[model samples]
Target: MTVLVINSGSSSIKYQLVDPESGEAIAVGLVEQIGESTSRVKHTYDGEKHEYEQRLADHGEGLRFVLDLFDSVGPSLAEAGIVAVGHRVVQGGDNFNGPALITEDVRDLIEELAPLAPLHNPANLRGIDVARELLDVPHVVVFDTAFFQTLPEEAARYALNREVADRYGVRRYGAHGTSHQYVSHKASEWIGREDLKQIVLHLGNGASVSAVVNGEAVDTSMGLTPLEGLVMGTRTGDIDPAVIFHLSRVAGMSIDELDDLFNKKSGVKGLAGENDMRAVWDMADSGDENAREALDIYVHRLVKYIGSYAAVMGGLDVIAFTAGIGENDDRLRAEVLERLAPFGVKIDPEVNAVRGDNIRAITTADSSVTVLVIPTNEELAIARQTMDVVATLS
Candidate 1:
């Protein structure tokens, strides 16, 4: 069966068409700079890339452009056997633990939870509405928070007034559930032990750290929103909420202004003036002091999470790094491992040099915790879950 996964953001839409039987992406693409005059799309299929420029004022237009792309330059949906449309929903609240067949009630609930994921849920719902209108297919909403639903109440709850907390739905809702879920299974397979404890550090443009015990997510760093996790490409992770009020009252910034600032103007970009780690590394290599400090802060933040998660899980058996920075940047892997020395984590420098989908143990033989690099495939995880959900419904 084929499933088309749509991940819609404010100004962009990412899509993948996959065949679940072999777990291969038949096609993938993104529509960028929506609402801009020179909006563009880059779609790839059968090892060929097709690029086009057009004005896409909204998610509906963006998705239509995608379907038209496949119709013009690639295989038709019928030919691809696209049996289902799986959406990347950002928040499921406490109600959804798995992918749900999109329905009027589900859509209403997703709309109600929009405030929790202001940057994502609305856009996701827009794409959902467009896809449902444009295609005659079974639609499913695969939530990014669903995997962390397994987190125990002790880990998921916040220490606040019970009545207020319950009324406000105040709790940790971890992000990157698809990536964490995929890598945890891969880690279990790699070590040949399903009953092992693993720490998954999904480092990328957006990052999160998750603790998986015996194939289930126990705790994750991202809480309430993607902004509440490890330092990321742009978002300032784990800041005091008072900072928001202070910026609003003292700096005279609106909530929208503050939200846009922290979510888009901060993180490694605000710190080093560049979000790309490669550029940051290059500047640091040339003895740029600010770049050096930015790199240190980034790695330091990651190590603290690793240490904290280790404490949470009692001890770490395996540490697996995935996502963009984790799998491709050896410098990051090296720096993270070096800082985690106190935890008895050691990486074999030679073994860590390889990159991109090549899984290998980076840990020294005598290290107490095994360190590994695993590439993340979130769409495949979505496809698998979509299939599982469809099977149960069947």
Candidate 2:
């Protein structure tokens, strides 16, 4: 069966049409700058790619554009017969610990939780509504936070007034659950152990680390939002949040401006004036002191978390790296493994050189823990969840 997965962001919509039976993507692309006059879409299928620029007043219009492209590109929309439409919903709150069918009640619940993910939930709802109108197929909402619902209460709760936190929904709701969950399951299989203790380092444009015990998320770095975690491409992760108040009192900046800076202007971006790690590494290699410092801070935080997770899990059996930076950057992996030597982690330089979408063991055979580079597949995870939803309905 085929499934269509949609991940809607504030100004972009990424979509993938997958044949889950074969575990291959039939078509995938992104429509960016929605609500902007210069909006554009780039789509690819069967080795062919096409780009288009036009106005997209909102997600509804952008999704319509996607439908037209699917028809014009190659596949007959009917023949593709998307059995389900899965969304990458950012927050599901305590009520939804798993994927759920999109009903009016579900939509209302999502709306109520929007403040927790203001930059994401509204856009996600827009995609859901638009997809529902265009396709009379099953629609499922797979939350990014749902995967971490397994976090122990001690790990999930904050040290605050219980009544106040519950009233305001101000508790830890880890992000990157989808990526962490995917990598953990894949790591378990790679390690050939069903009950595995694993640490998943999902380093990328936006970074987070997770500790999974026996396929359940025990603890994760990100809290409430993606803004809390290891240093990211453009986010200041795990900072004294009082810095927001300090910025307001000292610089007289508004809350929106502070949010913009911390969520979009900080991290390695603020330090080196760039977010792409490749660019930062190149500058660092050429004697850019600030860029070099950014790299150091990024890797240092990752190592710190790995060590913390090792302690949390009593001992880690496997460590998996995934996402854009983690799976491809051999040097970064080498450095992280070097720091994890206390845990007997070692990367064979030859094994690290191999790169692709496949999973591979990067550590030497004798290491205490198996180190792996497993590419994350969030879209496929959404698709599988969507398939499950459809099966239930049928």
Candidate 3:
């Protein structure tokens, strides 16, 4: 049996038909620029790619077109044995601790929580509504924030006024919890220990770190929204709250403009004038001072978090790096771990330099902490969760 995983954004839908038992994505596709004059659709199956363009009015039309592609192309869904459709919802608030079957009530709850994730939940709900209408399969919602529901009170709450915070639903609801949970569990399985204290750095265009103990999340970087946490590609992570007030007063910047600045024009792009890590690295190698400083700032924030989490967890037994930069950037990994030399972390340069898809240790065998590079598969995680939720109905 297969599960169809859907990660819908404000303007695009990314999908994968997956075999949960074998962990293979049978087909993968994306529909971009929905509700545009010309929307692009790309589908790949059997090692071949098919691309097309059409004028789509909305998500429903875009999805219908995708269904047509599935029918016209090979591996028809009717024959593919699709058991469930997993929708990736960004914010679950404190309402859901795990994947939930999409009932009318659940769908309404997702809609209710839209204020918390203004950009993601509505689109996710759109995909869910359309897919449910068209597919006639059991649908499941896998939340990015669900895995972080286990965070302790101290980690989840902000220092602001409790009344206002509650009224505004302001708290540390982290993004990338799915990735952190998946990688942390894989790290525990790989290390053969369930009680290990671990830190997972999900470094990508969007970066976040989490502290896990015994396979449960204790603390995470992102708070209130994804705008908090480690330095990101375009976000001003961990910025001073007073900066907003100062900008409003001195610069006369409206909230919307300030939001645009911090969320879109800041971070690596703000510092180095380039958001892509590879471009930043090229500039740094060419002795561009701004790019070099951006790299330093990024690594500095990482080191700081690692030290803080080590203290919070009492001690650290494992450190797992996943996601794009975490998995591929050997140089950044080396720099981050090397800064932790005082903690008895010793990474084997040879092992760290080797690039592969499988989980492997980058630390020396005798090192105090077992450092690993585990590739995160969020799609497979969602698929398995979807299957689990569907199985409960039977």
TM-score of each: 0.96, 0.97, 0.98
For 1-394, candidate 2 gives per-residue lDDT tens digits of 7999999888899999988777799999999999887998999998999999999998888998899988889576688877888899988988788899999999899989999999889988888888989998888999989988888999999998999988899878888888888889988887778798899999889899999999999999988888997999999998997898899999999989999999999999999999999999999999999999999999999989988988999988888999999999998899878887876777788999889889999889898888899999999988987888888886
**Cα lDDT for residue 131, candidate 1:** 94
TM-score leader: 3
Against the reference, the lDDT scores of all candidates come to 0.90, 0.89, 0.94
Model 2 residue 137 distance off true place after TM-score fit, in angstroms: 0.8
| RMSD per model, one decimal | 1.5, 1.2, 1.0
lDDT of 2: 0.89
True-structure Cα RMSD, model 1: 1.5
Candidate 1 residue lDDT tens string, 158-227: 8889899899998999999989988989988988999878999999999999999999999999998899
Regions of candidate 3 where Cα sits further than 4 Å from its true position: none
Residue 216 local lDDT, model 2: 93
Clash totals for all candidate models: 0, 0, 0
The total number of steric clashes, by the backbone 3 Å criterion, in model 3 comes to 0
Backbone clash total, candidate 2:
0
Candidate 2 vs candidate 3: the lDDT winner is 3
